[model samples]
Structure formats: structure tokens, C-alpha cells
Target: MEAKEKVYLAGGMESDWHEKLKQRFHNKFLFYNPKDHQLDASEQYTLWDLHHIKKSDIVFAYLEKDNPSGYGLTLEVGYAKALNKTIILVDEKSDTNNEFKARFAIVKNSASAVFDNLEEGIKFLERFSIYVG
Candidate 1:
């Protein structure tokens, strides 16, 4: 049997979006949610994130424009880029009519693919990987 591809869901844990995404992609890939772990310490969380980002095949980053200051997410994206992991960056605050506003520059540039929202990102993922179907 082939090994399942791993995708690390990164970004704000303010909502249940990560959990929902995991459920959505459960059958397609092995989804790792850092939020599920009991990472009470910032150091522990950072270490855990770094380890998984290195192991994952793809890093799916969801960054809302309103919540743009993700120190951890920024670092993870940079590391993933250096390690040659596929990065799917979703800019949740992007307006379809005005693309210039609310874009996360570093993450957007480092990403292998960028999307406006989670829904659009998921659609892109489906087409980009045969395993997603």
C-alpha cells in the first residue's frame, strides 16, 4: 500500500476552521492539527509545529486579513519554503474585486499556490493533487 500524504493545517486557532478542514480532507490525506495537541507552552507549540512542517508534504496556511500578525505561521511558512514543501496559502481577507488589499506578502510569495479563501483553496487542492479526490 502507498503511504498517505501528510498536510499540516497552520494558522489561527481562533475558530474551528482547522478542525473543519481536517474533516473535509480526512479521507484524502493525513491531516495534522496542532490545535488538537495540549501545547500549553509557546515553546512546545513552536517545536511541535516545526517538527510537523518538516514532515508534512504540504503546509496549508489560512491567514485572515483581519488577523495578519501570525509570528508562528510566518516562521513555519519560511521553514516550509526552505524545505521545499508545497505551501498552499489562503488569504481569507482578499476581496474578489480588489486583489491589492489585505495580502500577506511573505506567505503569498513563499507559497507554491495562493487562494482567496478556504473554499477556493480546497478546490485548488483537489485539482492539484490526485490524492485529494
Candidate 2:
């Protein structure tokens, strides 16, 4: 059997978004949620997160435009870019027209694909991503 693709869910820890994805795609993909690996020290998490990022096949980053100051999300995107990994970015800063206005420059430039919201991005991934069915 082919090995399942590993995904690193990178985003704000303010909600259960990561859990929802894992629940939705648990059988199809293996996921690494940073919150599950938190340590007492910030530096420890940095190293741990990088290690997981290296191991993952795709970095599915869901960054809301209103919550744009994420150091970990930024670093993960840049590192994934350097490593030539697949990156699916959701930059959710939308207008009434549902046009995405918010973006992180580095993540946007590095992303293999970008969407205005998680649902849209998921649809793209399910349709086009090598690992996601």
C-alpha cells in the first residue's frame, strides 16, 4: 500500500479548526497539529514544529487576515518554501464580495496555491492535491 501523506496544520490556535480537519480526513492523511506538541518553552516548540514541517508532505496553513501576526506560520511557510514542499494557504481576509484582501506577503509568495477560506482551499486540495482525496 502507498504511504499516506502527512500534513502539518499551521494556523492560529484560537479554535478547533485543526481538530475539524483531522476529523474530516483522518483516514486519508496523517496530521501534525502544533498544539498537540507544545512544550514548556517557546524555543522547544520552534524546533519541534520545524521537525514536523520537514516530515510533512504538505503545509496547510489557514491564516485569518485579522490574525496576521503569527511568527510560527510565517517561519513554517518560509521553511516549507525553501524545502520545496507543497503549501496550501488560506488567507481569510475577505470583503462583502468574498474577495480575499488579507495576505501574508511571504506566505502568499511561497504558496503553491491560495484560497480565501478554508472550505475553498479544502475543495482545491481534494480535487488537485496529490495526497488529499
TM-scores of the candidates in the order shown: 0.84, 0.85
Model 2 ranges off by over 4 Å: 94-103, 128-133
- Model 2 lDDT tens row, 1-133: 5687889988888888888888877688888899898586988988988999999989999886666466678889999999999999987743322333344464688899988788998877565335444
What stretches of model 1 exceed 4 Å from their correct place? 94-103
Per-residue error (Å), model 2, residue 70: 2.4
Cα-based RMSD of the predictions, in order? 3.1, 3.5
* Alpha-carbon deviation at 99 in model 2, angstroms: 16
How much lDDT does each candidate structure score?
Answer: 0.79, 0.80
Model 2 pairs in collision: none
Which tens-of-lDDT digit does each residue in 1-133 have in candidate 1? 4566788988887888887776776677888789888788988988988999999998998876666466667788899999999999887654532444444475678999988888988887665457444
lDDT of 1: 0.79
